[model samples]
Target: MPEKSERQLLPLADSDDRQDLRADCGSCFGLCCVALTFSKSSDFPVDKAAGTPCTNLRQDFRCGIHQKLRQKGYSGCTVYDCFGAGQKVSQATFGGTDWRQDPETARQMFDVFPVMRQLHELLWYLTEALTLPQTRPITAELRRALEKTERLTEGTPAAVAETDVAAHRADVNVLLLRTSDLVRADIRRKKKDRRGADLFGARLRGADLRGVTLRGACLIAADLRGADLRQTDLIGADFRDADLRGADLTGSIFLTQSQVNAAQGDAETKLPPFLARPTHWDRPGP
Candidate 1:
């Protein structure tokens, strides 16, 4: 890893309206710190159960080791992005009343957090789909799905918790699949279909992966250095500890920041204009 950084040459199209989709910890009630569970592993130093507050969580709903999470054996926290679900739950659904202020609603808030998180993640994908010129044929359907998901986020905590998230997710997945096909339709080369493949720790360095559908692929610790990933669909691919140094992922569809954050990359790695390079990439890995 090097201290130098890379910059995107072009601005992210339609990303100006996505400010709310990015997490705002300052306005959040630290729901992720208390609501999620973790197992002791390479990503975490200790095993913890759901609904238990992380040991590093401070009284003000901030991580005491926020600046040193990775060095302190909490790499899991560094990669976890709730996509702004925390602040929305804290400020809007609960009317700004934190779980601490109303202990009775703590369980409800915790339950609703995951539900809201799922909805927000869909919103993220839908928003990105709408930005693609190829998806213009189904843009109206995408907008309708986005609006319905957005409305779901604004429901009562109980309503949100009880939402048929799986049903809604299935409905949105249909549109997302169509969007993926539309985007990859222009590729001159025959694309690889590795959907849900188990390529864990597989050797694929410098591979030509353009226009491939790696959706839900388990790429944990896979060697992908210098691979060309332009136009690849990476919606739910797991990149934990994957080596992506020198990889080119520009124009890759449905790739999220959290996925990039989990992988090992260097300054030479090319990313979509919308994603920020993980700061830890500048430091030596543990």
Candidate 2:
């Protein structure tokens, strides 16, 4: 397991890296709660539209159920953090003003979130690349990439917010591909290209599935407890009844929140960052 410091710097962990991404929440204007939307899913028990502040959000930009969200109906809140983008858009972009005060900038802030999220995700991966001793061969290149992404984070809110994130992501993806090839070449031999394969009820506990392409695979009822699912392409994979207890799904791309909410797990199940545990799991009532 990585140390806390390392975990904080890398968003590719089993938990969120908000503590290291940035700590300027006090400077934010609560952009997330006021800008994002959610449906009444197993993860979130209420229906919320975009641009509407969550009912639990306080006037001070804090959640009323910040401590007991799982007990309440907001288990999703516990896992969602803005990666300092909230504060960045609030203070840096809009000059520390709230949407209630300046409604005109609310749409811009909302539009910028998905862009910033992509950048932040890149930062997470680049930071992880910096820590791998195996990538010593391309450490300088990786460092350059990391520094470039860091510089993007420091840009003015307007500039960062208006950036062509898709183009930037393409460039970053190219670099990451090289890095992955260099560092994961040895372990690549065992990678299974099970893209779109039906894996229902497969006992894959503790499997070494690094770099495997399991895109669109039916993983229903699969025992994936303690599996190393890093860098696996899980796009459209069905996780119903999949025992993800203690599984490490860091860097698993294209996995959606809806899919996770539809799955079954318990406290013992480890999940990717930005995803909360299912609410009714192991509970008596539906």
Candidate 3:
């Protein structure tokens, strides 16, 4: 794909807190590289099993190709960030231990990474929402919800690891519904029963859109680069110009592999289908 534009890389409403979250990766034990898996596909050029450290992961818990992962057959690595969960588990939960010294803790640390990552991801969106003047109508409610979710991140690793993250996510969805009702009331009022309305050009960058019903909607030109689309119903939705770089579309229902292949994405996009990758990214000229 063309070198992603700055606008595309850092979508409107990008938060400095989110960038700060990424900067603390060195404090992490590289949980994502060791805990996740990949298949030989267009997105990742090798097969790696879960709990196996990626070959590019250096002994110091740094990526050997950190600056040029895409050029080294590890484009998937460019898109993967643990959202500070790695450090949270590595330092706070596991007390700065690596799997090499205490192998048994590895499983617990791995299990907790996804849980903490989800909460940190929410923190990213809520923090971004708090910065938008247009979204100020619901700022109080948003702040309250944000604090509540942040508290969840600080919970004991045992509690966080065992909690039903999906249920907690649903609870947060109720809060997001109130926020969306306040902000999207204008658009919602224009369309009678916008349970699944077309939202072309809707400036939803960095918005929390988890579990929203967007079936058959036209999402062209919609800045969704960092919006949470997990478990959302996206059957037949058009995604042209809908920046998905750095967005997580995992577990989303009805999003076909072919549709993603047809859409414009880049190295930062995280797709589902386990093994498929985008084929239509606009690559830069040689």
Q: Could you tell me every candidate's TM-score relative to the true structure?
A: 0.93, 0.68, 0.62
Q: Mark the 10 consecutive residues where model 2 has the least summed lDDT.
A: 1-10
Please write out the lDDT profile of model 3 over residues 106-165, one tens digit for every residue.
Answer: 887888888888876666556555554445666777677777776777678788888677
Q: Give the TM-score of candidate 1.
A: 0.93
lDDT of 3: 0.65
Over 1-286, each residue of candidate 2 has an lDDT whose tens digit, in order, gives: 1112334333223333434444355776666677789999766898999988889888888877876776786766655645456665666556667777878877777777666766766765666555555556766776677667666766765777778878877787676656666555656676767878889999888998887767579998898888898867565578765777778776665455556765666676656665556665657434
Per-residue lDDT over 168-250 for candidate 1, one digit per residue giving the tens place of the 0 to 100 score: 99999999999999899888257669999999998999998988999999999999999999999999999999999999999
Candidate order by TM-score, highest to lowest? 1, 2, 3
The candidate that wins on lDDT is 1
CA displacement after TM-score superposition, residue 19 of candidate 2 (Å): 4.4
Q: Ranking by lDDT, best first?
A: 1, 2, 3
After superposition, the stretches of candidate 3 with alpha carbons farther than 4 Å from their true spots are 1-20, 134-137, 187-286
Winner on lDDT between 2 and 3 is 2
- Between candidates 1 and 3, name the one with more favorable TM-score: 1
lDDT agreement with native, every candidate: 0.88, 0.67, 0.65
Candidate 1 lDDT for residue 34: 89
